[model samples]
Target: MTRVAVIARILPVLAILVWSLQGVSRAENALTLDLSDYELTFEEDFDRLDVSAWGPGTRWIAHTPWNGDFGDAAFADPRPGFPFTVKDGVLAIEARKDEGGKWASGLLASVDGAGRGFSQRYGYFEMRAKFPKGEGTWPAFWLIGLDRLTHTSEVDVVEHYGHFPGRYTASVHVWDRKTASKSSSVHHRVLVAPGSLYDDYNTFGAKIDADWIIFYFNRQEVWRQSTPEHHKQPMYLLVDLGVGAGWPTENTPDPSVMLVDYVKVWARED
Candidate 1:
């Protein structure tokens, strides 16, 4: 064979090899939730409605005038099952409009409502959840002051506004002199290309400490920033399914559910 023929054949094979390697590199970069080196403090798998764990009883309290704020939906107690349910090994929060044309949803807090649950100072917190597919459906996994922040310190693990498909945000807010303003606030929207987060369960996490706060999606580090000063105290966890947080709700579906596979908290033993 002439040198030109040999070169052409080899070039095509080399190009194919390069493309395959690039694809592999991209896959390797995606981090799946891997538990390692942290001592678990709490976990809820939703195998059943463990009322002793966190439904309408001692483990967690349903929303009341105290712990319910944000978005256009009102959080209702899960007694009549308007917004929350544990079925088929998953905890689901449904967002819908009532007969009065008002929106109602679910919001669960660890240390508020009628009964106080648990709180931790600094640790690793995570939730494995699948978002609902509907415009204006807002879901959040977050932490706030246990009793009161004194100032206001909030850690937003994952806030997904369903209208912005394939993206979710994380943020930290340290209050200024008042709750309306912030001393230091950091936020970012993690963009996942070619896939929808609502299509499957993905883990969102936050590792909190005295110095810095790290946010993760699917167990991969996505964003980080300096820790807030007033956040030195403990915080309680919360999850909510909200609607129309200033997002367009004209076309929002009548019913949508955010499925939570599990939620966990971990700490360092030492």
Candidate 2:
């Protein structure tokens, strides 16, 4: 996810909490909603890359619903094997440079501009992925509010930059379209051992409810903040292999690939 305005000294750093996962246990590989007091609502194991369907009633679109393509790469549409590929139940979102020196990448949204697809008002959303390592590689999993007429609410589950080896950010933003300003915003950084994220797959998740929005790394709580008022409505999902987040992409890995094992969401069973 990209920030709309330049975060100068004006935007206060709400929290800077760090949890080192040095010796964390990696038990319980299987994901289940029963123990969490929730029910499975949506899941995408990437059995296949369905590019033919890219609109309302479909599973995904190639770009953001608002057509905002951020970072150093253009979110390219699905092609033969350029930006997207599926093999053995894994989805690889690739970023590469073309002969013309233009960078193109892949992004997938759960809904289209017409506000049709899978979305939930509040739930626990998770993505298990292995991030690409190299300067200028930006991978993110985020959510945006469905109601885009007036204001917009955003929840960034995980935004990892390649330069920062074992650090990622999660944030919440409430932007008012009429005033073009963020009414509420908060940013937090989570840290672990350097280069640990690039070695293997890890899970990043967020739990959103009426009172708070909590972030989790490997299913462990890391940070939390009050849920914005505008975010109470249903929101859709987006995962992308971006290029640069206010950094240089000249030395970026030509074919940086982000492998996603799965994306799943569970709604409270109440």
Best by lDDT: 2
Per-residue accuracy of model 2 over 1-270 as CA lDDT, tens digit each: 546323322245322222323323232343333236889999899999765335755688888888777777999878898688999999999999888998999999998878778889999999999999999999999999999778778899999888888688888887666654435567777777778778999998888999988788888777777787899999899999999887888889899999999999999899
Please list the Cα RMSD from the true structure of every candidate, rounded to 1 decimal place.
15.2, 5.0
Tens-digit lDDT track for model 1 on 201-248?
A: 888899888997877877887776677677777878888888877778
lDDT of 2 at 248: 86
Give each model a TM-score.
0.81, 0.87
Q: How high a TM-score does candidate 1 get?
A: 0.81
Worst 10 residues of 1 by lDDT: 15-24
Candidate 2 residue spans exceeding 4 A from truth: 4-35
Checking candidate 1 for backbone clashes, the offending pairs are none
Q: Which candidate gets the maximum TM-score versus the true structure?
A: 2
Candidate 1 — which residues are off by over 4 angstroms? Answer: 1-35, 50-57, 113-115, 147-149, 177-179
